[model samples]
Target: MATIFTPGPALQSNSSEQNRFMEKLMAKILSFYDEQSLIDVTFKVSNPTAVVPAHRLILAAASPYFENLFRGEQGNNPVIEINDIDSDTLERLITFCYTGEAPITVNNVGAMLKAAIVLQLNDAINSCVDCIMKNINGYTLQAAYTLERETQCERLKQKLIEYEIKNFMEISRGVEFLSFDVEKLQRILESDNLNIPREEDAYDAIKRWFNYDVPARQEPLPHLIACLRLTQFDADFLLTHIQPLPGCELLAFKAISWIREPAARTKISMRFTEPRATCEETFLVICRSEMNYKLLQYNKAEDKWQEYASLEIDYTNYWPILKDENILFIGGYKNGVSCNIVRSLNIRNKTWQNLPAMNQARRGHRVVELDGKIYAIGGLEGNKVLSSVERYTPSDGWEFVSSLTVGRFDASAEILNGKLYVLGGRNINGALKLVECYNPDSNTWTSCADMTECRVSLHVRVHKGHIYVLEKYSANQSSQSVERYDPERNTWSKICCLNAEWARIENVFSFDNKLWSFGHPKHDDISSVSVYDEDNDRWVKKCSLPNVDRYTYNIVPVALLSSK
Candidate 1:
C-alpha cells in the first residue's frame, strides 16, 4: 500500500520537477559524507550512509603526498582527520606541507611529533626535530629528550648531540639514552666538524662518557676534546668535564686549548674571579645609637646581617675589635670616660662577657688578633698621641706589648704575612706616609717601606696575597690609584685605579677575596659602591649600600664561618 502511494505521488509530479528533486537529495548526501570523511576516517568508513569508498577516503587523507599531482587543478578534496591529529599540530603540519614552514610552540610539539611518526612523514619529523633542538632551553630540554627517546628517532638524537643541547645534559644525573650505541656516540664525540652546544648537560654527558675512573685503552674522543675549547661555556662546566679525567691530563689539554689561545687565559681568569658582596652583605656605618653592641650573625644565603644580642656599654668609638666565632670589643669611649674595657660577645651563645681592660687607656685605635692574641694598637689617650700597644690573651688577660716607633692617631693596621703593617695616619702634624711593620716573634717595630702617596682616613684591604690601599690625597681631591704590595718581594706595583669618589670614603672592607668600599658620604651623587677586580685589574660598581648613613664610619667584615 505504501509503495502504491509513493509511485502515485512520483507519477503525479512533472518529470523535470522530479529529476531536480532527486539531484538535490543526492547532492546533500555527498556533502554530508565529504564533511564526515574530513573529520575522521573511522567515522566516514563506519557511517551507514557514506557513499565515498574507504580507499579513496584514505588517499584524500594523505593529500600532501600527491600535492604535485594537483599542482594546478582543483584536485580531489583533502580528508584530514582532525580528531586523529591535534588541531594545532594538524594546522602546523598542513602549513608545513603547503609552505615548507613549521611554527613550533611548546604545547603542540609532542602531538606533532607523534603524528609525524605515525604518518611516516620524514620531512615533517625532521622539521619537528629541528624546531625542538633550536628552541631547547633549560626548561624545555627534558621534555624534548623524552619525545626523541619515545620516537626512537636516531636522526633527532644526532641533531641534539650536534647542537650540544646543554639543558638536556646539565640536569641529567647519570648516563641517559643508555641503549644508544656507544660507538656512534664516540664517533660523534670525535668528529672535527660537529658543533656541540655549550650546555651544562652536554658537558656532564661528555665528562661521564670519556672521563671514567679506570683509564680506557681506547683512544680519547677528539671531538669531545675540541668541544672543551668552547670559551662560551661556564667554568663550572669546563671543570666538570676536565676534573674527572684525573691527574690533570684533560685539564692540561683544556688549559692549552682554552687558556693559551690568544687572551683566553685572561678571559678565563676574569670569569673565575670572585664576586663582590651586595649591600646586604656590606658593613654599614652605624652610629652610637644604632650600634647595639650585639652579636650579629651573618646569613649567607639570605645575604643579611642581624644583631643577636645587645650590650650595656655605648658603642660610639667601639669599632669591631677582634672577630672569630666571637666578636671582641675593646678600648671604646663609653659615656665621657675613655674605657679600656675589653669585652667579647659569643656569636654562637649570644652572650656578652667582660675581659681584662687594656694596659693603658686607648680610643680611636685598631685591635688586631694574631695567633689567638689581641693587640690594641696606637690611638688617642686624652689628646696625647700614644705609641703604646697591648696584647690580650684569654688565659693571661691584657699585657703590655712593644710600643709603636711613632705615636699616631687616625691610623690603620692590617695583619699581612704574619706581621702587622701600620700605614698612613694623621699625627698632630697632618698626614704621615710612614709604613712600619711589627714582628710578634721579635717584639720589635721596623720601617719596611713608605707609601707613594700620603693619605689620612684611608681604606686598606688585602686581596690575592697583595695589599691594596685606597685614600684621599687632599680635602678637595681624592686619589683612586691602587698600589699592590707583595710581602714576599717587598715590592709595590700599580694595578688599575678606581674612580675618585670610591677612594674618598673611609668605609672599606675586604671579604671573599674582593675589596669593597661603601658610597662616599661627601659624594652621595655616585650611586654605586666600589669593588676591585684583581684579575681584570679594574673596579666595578655593585648595588649601592642600603643605609648611606653608615658610609662615614669604619666598616669591618668578619668571616663568620667558611667551609673549604
Candidate 2:
C-alpha cells in the first residue's frame, strides 16, 4: 500500500546524547569481547604462557602496531607471539581497546605501560602513566623512574624527580635510593629544590650511597661531590669529613678557599650557593575585629590577605612568635590588665595548646628566640614598668636571665650577633632615646648607641647584620623616620623617611626577605602594606590588608612551620 510513512522525531545530536550512545556502544563491544564473539586474532604471551583472543578490527582501530601489522595480508585468526608482555597485560590492553579503560593500578602499571608501548596504544599508555604518577610512593618510585627512562616520558620523569627531591630525607634511607644511577643521583643533588636541612646532608647521603657498594660507586664520588653546595659547608665539616675521602680532597679544599675568602665567594658556582627549599616564609597578622580575634596571613605574591585562624579570646595586642609550626601568643592585655597567659596555635593542624605562662604578667614586650631559647624582654606589669628579663628553655621553663638597663614598655627589640638589643621606649617619665644590649654569654647589659628620636611602640627588625627601627606616628613629629643601627660600628644612621601618607603606620617588620611597613593613611580606614626599597630608599606601596584597620592590627613574620 502507498501509505505515507511518517518519520519519527529525530534524535538530538547533543553532547549528552552522543555520550550515552558511545557508552552503550562501548558496553556492547566489551560484551562481545567477553563472549569471545567475532574474534579474529590470538595473542600468545610467554613468561607464564597464556592466550588472549581479540577482534582484529578492534585491535587495529585501537593500536597503530596492530593496524600496520595487518594492513597487507588478510588472515583468519592470525596468531601473534608477544615475548615481552605477559598474558594478564595483554588481556588488559585488549579490554582497554574494547571499553577505552583498563584496571591500571600501581602494581600492574609498569607491565601495562610496557604492553601499551609495544602495541603503540596511546590511550592505554596515558592511563598507565597517570596511574604510576598518582600512586608513586617510596616502594614504587624507583620502578616508575626506570619505566619513565625506558619510555622517555618527560612529564613522568619530572614528576618523579620532584617527588624524590621533596622527600629526599626519607627516600635517602631506603634501599630503592641505592638503585639510582650516578647520573640520576647527580641531577637530584644539583637541584636547589632538594628539601635537605643542610648541604652536609646531601654529602652524607652521597657517602651512604657510595659506601653501599663502594667498588661500584667509588669512581663517581668526585662527580657526585661536585653537585653539592660545597660553600655551605664549614671548615670543620670540610677538613673532618671531606678531606678524608679518597678523591674529594680537591673539591674540599676549593670549597674551603671560597669560604675563607669573602671576595672569592662570588667565584663559587651559583648552583652550589643557592639556598634549598627547606622552609617557607609567611606574614601572620593578628588583629581584633568587632567580635573575635582574627589571625590573617598575607599572601605577598598574590597581594591578598587570607584569614588563617580565629580565636575567641577577650584580649588584644598579643604577640605571635613563630616557634616551629606553632605561633606562640605570649602575653596580652585582657580586661584592662596584663596577663601572662601563653597560648600556642599549631598552624598545620589548627589546634590550640596552652603553654606555661611567663614569669611576669607583661604586655608591650618583645620576644626573641635565640639558640633554641626564648627570651621575653622588658614590659610593664600593671602601672610599674619592669626592667626584668626572663628566658625560657625546654629543660628549665622560665628563669631570670638578665634584666634590662632601663624598665620600659612598648619598646622594640631584636637579636643581633647573639645579643639582644632593646631600643627606645616610653617610661613613666615619657619616651627615652635609650638603647641597651644584653649579652647572654656574659649575663650583663651594655649600652649601645641611642636612636635619634624617642620612640614608643616602635617596630624593630634585624636584617643583614643591622637593626632597623621604624618609629610610630606622634602629633609632635612632622615626619616618621627609619633608623638603621650598625652593631659593629655601634652607631645610628637614618636610612630614609616614611611617606607622609604612612604617618599613621601601625607595624613594620621583615617579611619575604624585605623590610615592610603596614598601616593606614591619615583619616583612612583601609590599611596599606609597603615594602622598603633599599636601593631606592623609599617605601613602595604594595597592597592593603584585608579586614584590618590602621589602629588594631599586630603583624609578625612566621617563616617555618613544623609538620609535627
lDDT of 2 by residue, 365-397 (tens): 878886557888888788889899998876788
C-alpha lDDT score of every prediction, in listed order: 0.57, 0.76
Q: Give the runs in model 2 whose Cα sits over 4 Å from its true position.
A: 1-268, 272-275, 474-478, 533-538, 547-564
Best by lDDT: 2
Q: Estimate the TM-score for candidate 1.
A: 0.45
lDDT per residue (tens digit) for residues 1-564 in model 1: 445435566555788887887789656644654455443222122212232222233333445443333343533444423345545555455445434567766667677788777656667788778778767773276687788778878777777676542223333333454323455555544343333222233444555565452356125444444443344333333444444444545453455455336555554433222211211122423322355333334344665555434456554565465343455777767666666877776543556787787878877787777755788888887788889888887679888888898888778888765689888886788778788899999999998667776767666776545677766443445446667677778776777566445424655665443566555435565435667786786667665534423323332323222221
Q: How much is 234 displaced in model 1, in angstroms? A: 22
Taking all chains together, each candidate's TM-score versus the true structure is 0.45, 0.55
For candidate 2, list the clashing residue pairs, or say none.
Answer: 325-561, 325-562
